[model samples]
Target: MTTHNTAEMRICDAIWSIGVMLDYTQKIAGFVTPELLDWRPEFPAGDFAFSLGEQLMHITDIRMWIVSQLGTEKHAYERWAGPYPGIDQPWTFRAGSHSEVMEALESSRQLVQPWIERPMGELSLPTAGTVAAWEKALAAMREKGEDTSQLEAKGAGTLGSALFFLLAHENGHRTVTQTMLRMAGAPVERLA
Candidate 1:
């Protein structure tokens, strides 16, 4: 029997985490009916207490947000085309129906699929030409004396951390969703 190196083990763990998240997503999707989509706890906490549909949509929203940051060419904010629930604005994408919400969830999965499929060995290495392109852009910004603070604040952009972020983020949403379902009286069974 062969033992894997630390990097290989880490990647395998990340893959396992992703699989667990997928299972949670599918289980939640299975029990959420169309009527329950708009259900929310009567005790309100403003937007913090999102409806069942928003809670589900938020899972996809945040998933895409994190995945978009992993790209070499564009930032997450730059690539965000859907409703952005910024400080003042509200999210506009309606979880119109059960099927629509599922479709959005599918789109989110697709965004992260490439990273999941990447070889563990290749993930540690920079993509060919990507580093050069990034350097060139950074050099131009520095030469122009432009502020790079926003650019710097984007997380490490490493595959490991990004995968971890996806898992952690989805886990939070999963908890919220399950709680929301329970409050709405449609709680799904916990995975065995």
Candidate 2:
């Protein structure tokens, strides 16, 4: 019997959780028919919305960012585009067919594998870019005089937290995508 180091176990758990979330996302995405891929909720003009395919693409985009930003690969860092501005800003991502979106997710996993397989000192360091983005995201909530202390604490700032953030972020969008699929008459189960 082997005894496990707590830090190692925590890191393993974090990686495992990310993997499980990715698998669940893939399974749910599998149910998205081509017909439902472009469907989005009927929001008012100027309101924010994402088509089903865009949602999947968005998930892959953030995952790629995390790996590129925090990973050990010099090439990935060199090729990394700057951080995304905001949700309201125009997205450069062009949503493709179901197979293409699935391929994107799979490639994101491959890109992240080598980074996560090795331990890095930066894993525990605060992720300044992500923290700044969180502050921007919380601006509206703060304006409403709402208590956002808890959320601020949970914001992703470390490489480890950023990995978990991928799950939380994707899971939130997956709900919207799954709902749109259901409305489009596709059978999207509650896989998560």
User: Which prediction has the highest TM-score against the true structure?
Assistant: 1
Candidate 2: which pairs clash?
127-157
User: For residues 77-153, what per-residue lDDT tens digits would candidate 2 score against the true structure?
Assistant: 22122346586775444537688777776778677665455454556866556566667668978999888888788
Instruction: Give the alpha carbon lDDT tens digit for every residue of 1-192 in model 1.
Output: 967664554444545667667667757766778888777777554553667777777777777766655665443332222555687565565426678777777777767776776667655554433344456667788899997776555423466666677788788888888877877778566764
Tally clashing residue pairs in candidate 2.
Answer: 1
Q: Count the backbone clashes (under 3 Å) in each candidate.
A: 0, 1
Q: Return model 2's CA RMSD, one decimal.
A: 8.0
Error in Å for residue 96 of model 1: 3.0
After aligning candidate 1 to the native by TM-score, how far in Å is the CA of 115 from where it should be? 1.3
